[model samples]
Structures are given as structure tokens and as C-alpha cells.
Target: MIKILKEVFQLYIDRSDFFLEILLQHMAICGIAIVIASIIGILLGIIISEFKKTTSPVLSLVNFIYTIPSIALLGFFIPISGIGDKTAIIALAIYALLPMVRSTYTGIETIDPAVIESAKGMGSTDYQILYKIKLPLATTVILSGLRNMVVMTIALGGIASFIGAGGLGVAIYRGITTNNAALTVAGSLLIAVLALVVDLIIGTIEKFIKRKWKLN
Candidate 1:
């Protein structure tokens, strides 16, 4: 184990460029997926929150998709989208919907009814209420969801290399096949570190937002 650790450390230092290339690939894949999930998830969340009637069915569908195994979902998309980052992004985005939508809904729903009524009394337009009141107020919770989605997406991005998406997973899968423990361990560590770094950044943002809100 010590020998393997030494080898992995040397590879990280000596071949930083090689790892950096794949790291960018991983970020691009996961970043696109996160954006897609946030847009559609937030939209669905808003819609369900407003309509209330649609909440059960919309959430139920998202929940169902979220429950599908990531690999199986990727396989299902392969025939239509074929093998590439697109398919991986789609799969990751789908998996991400539950957290984003749930948080958005919960954040909006939990806001005191009186606050909204006060906004209405102040002659706030629907758009103004949503833009200024609901979203701004719900941002902390939404950001919390964003953090989870990002971390989860990055971890899942590793599997994307399996479908030719090209990410840290390449190192991991290739290492597994070729029995290169250092490569495999290095890839796993990079993915984990990426997740941790991203989570911490978002957590910091959440803290800042919370503090600002409290001050107000």
C-alpha cells in the first residue's frame, strides 16, 4: 500500500497535465448537466408550487426518474442520443432533478404566507413577487440543493467515461482493466477531492447568503 501511495503521488506531480486534461472534461460534462437540471428543475418547481395541483404528478415523475439506476438510464439514452457527453449530461441532469425541484418547492412553500400577502398588499406584480420575493428569499435553500446536485453530479460524471464521455472515470475504468492501482486510486481521489472542493465552495456561498438574510 505504501508503495502504491508513493507511485500515485509521483504520478500526480509528474503527470499533472494528463490529469488536468481529463479534469476539464469532467467539469464540462458535469457543469452542463448541472445547468440543465437547475433550469428545468427550478421551472418545474415553480410551476408545481404555483399550481399545487401539479405537485403530486410532477414530483412523482421526477422521483421515478431519479430512482432509475444511473447506468440503466444511460443505457436507455444511448439508443436515442448515442454514446457521448450528451447522453451522460442528460442522465446526470435527470438524476439531479429530485433535489433541485424538491428544494425549490420546499423553500417557496415554507415561506410565511403573510410575507407573500404583504407583497401583494404593496402592489407587487406577480413577476415582481417571484423575482424579488420568492426566488430571493428561497435562494438559500435553492443554493443548498445546488450544492448537493453539483457534488452528486461530479461523482456520477466519473461513470460518464464508460460511455465515451471522457472524464476522471476514464482513469478509473482503464486502471481497473489494466490493473493499475495507482491510476485507479488517483482517479478516485481526484473525483472525491473535486466533490469536496465544490461542496465546500457552495457551503460557503450558502453561509454568506444566510448571514446576509439574517442581517436584513
Candidate 2:
């Protein structure tokens, strides 16, 4: 174990630039996917809550999407997007939708109906009520989902290399092919660390949102 750690440390020291490049690729893939997913998911979530009749069907479909295996889903996209970061980003965005959408839906749906009613009573329009009441109250939950989506995307981004997308997974796959356990371990450790660091940052944002809303 110590020897492996030493080897990984040595690898990091010897190949810092290469590792940094791989890390950046992984971050870029995750970052882009998360942003795209956030816009679509949040919008869908808002629409789902507004159009009550569509909620059941939409939730069911999103749940079904969550069950699809990531690799299979990625492959399903290859014929269209044709393998690369674009394909991986699309797949990650789809997978990320479930969490973001569900959270957004839950966040708004769970808001106190009385507050909305009060807002309406004050001559607030539908848009005003939603923007002021629903969205503000839902920020913490939405942020929580965002946190989950970011971490999940980062973790999954490692596999993007399988589709010719450059990332840390390249190191992992190369290590596997070359019988280099240390390289595999290093790649995996870096991915895990990246996920952890991002999660922590998101978590901090969540806390700030909670405090802003005095949710606690």
C-alpha cells in the first residue's frame, strides 16, 4: 500500500502537467454538462410544477431515464453525436436531468401553498408569485440537486475517455491496458478527489442559500 502511494506520488510529481491537463478535461466535460442540464432541468421542473397535469408523465419518464445504464446510453448517442466530448456531455446532461428536475420539482411543489396564496392576495401575478415565492423558497433544494448533479457528472466524466473524450479516464484505461496498477490508482484517486472537492464547494453554496433564506 505504501509502495503504491509512493509510486502514485512520484507519478504526480513526474507528470504534474499531464495530470493537470487530464483534470482540466474532466472538469470541462462535467462543467459544460452541468450548465446545460441546469438550464433544461430547472426549466422543465418549473414547467412541470406549473402544468400540474403533465407532472406524472414527466416524472415517470425522468425516472425511466435514470435507470438507463450510462455506458449503454453513451453508446446510444454515438451514431448521432459520433463519439467525443459532445457525446459524453450529452449523456451526462441526460443523466443529470433526473436529479436536477426532481429537486426543482420537489423544491417548488413543496413550498407552502399559503405563501403563494398570500402573494396572490397581494395582487402578485403568476410570474411574481413564482419568482418571489416559489423560486426563493426552493433555492436550497435546487442547490442541493445542483450539488448532486455536479458530483455525479464529475464522477461519470471519467468514463468519457472510453468514447475518445480526453480526461483522467484516459490514464485509467491506459494504465489498465499497460498493466500499470499505480497509474490506474492514481487516475481513480484524482477523479475521486475532484468529485469530493466539487461536492464540498457545492455544499458550501447550499449552506449559504439556506442561510440566505433562513431555512434552518
- Give me the runs in candidate 2 sitting further than 4 Å from their true place: none
Quote the positional error of residue 201 for candidate 1 in Å: 0.9
lDDT of 1 by residue, 1-216 (tens): 999989999989998998999999999999999999999999998999999899999999999998898988988999999998899998999999999999999999989999999999999998999989999999999999999899999998999978888889999999999999999999999999999999999999999999999999
Candidate 1 overall lDDT versus native? 0.93
Tens digits of per-residue lDDT for model 2, 1-216 = 999999999999999999999999888888999999999999999999999998999889989998999989889999999989999999999999999999999999899889888888899999998897899889989999998888888888888888988889989989988999999999999999999998998898888877776644
Alpha carbon deviation, residue 107, candidate 2 (Å):
0.4
Instruction: Please state the error at residue 82 of candidate 2 in Å.
Output: 0.7
> Which 10-residue window of candidate 1 scores lowest in summed lDDT?
158-167
Pairing residues by index, what is the TM-score of model 1?
0.97
Per-model TM values vs. the true structure: 0.97, 0.97
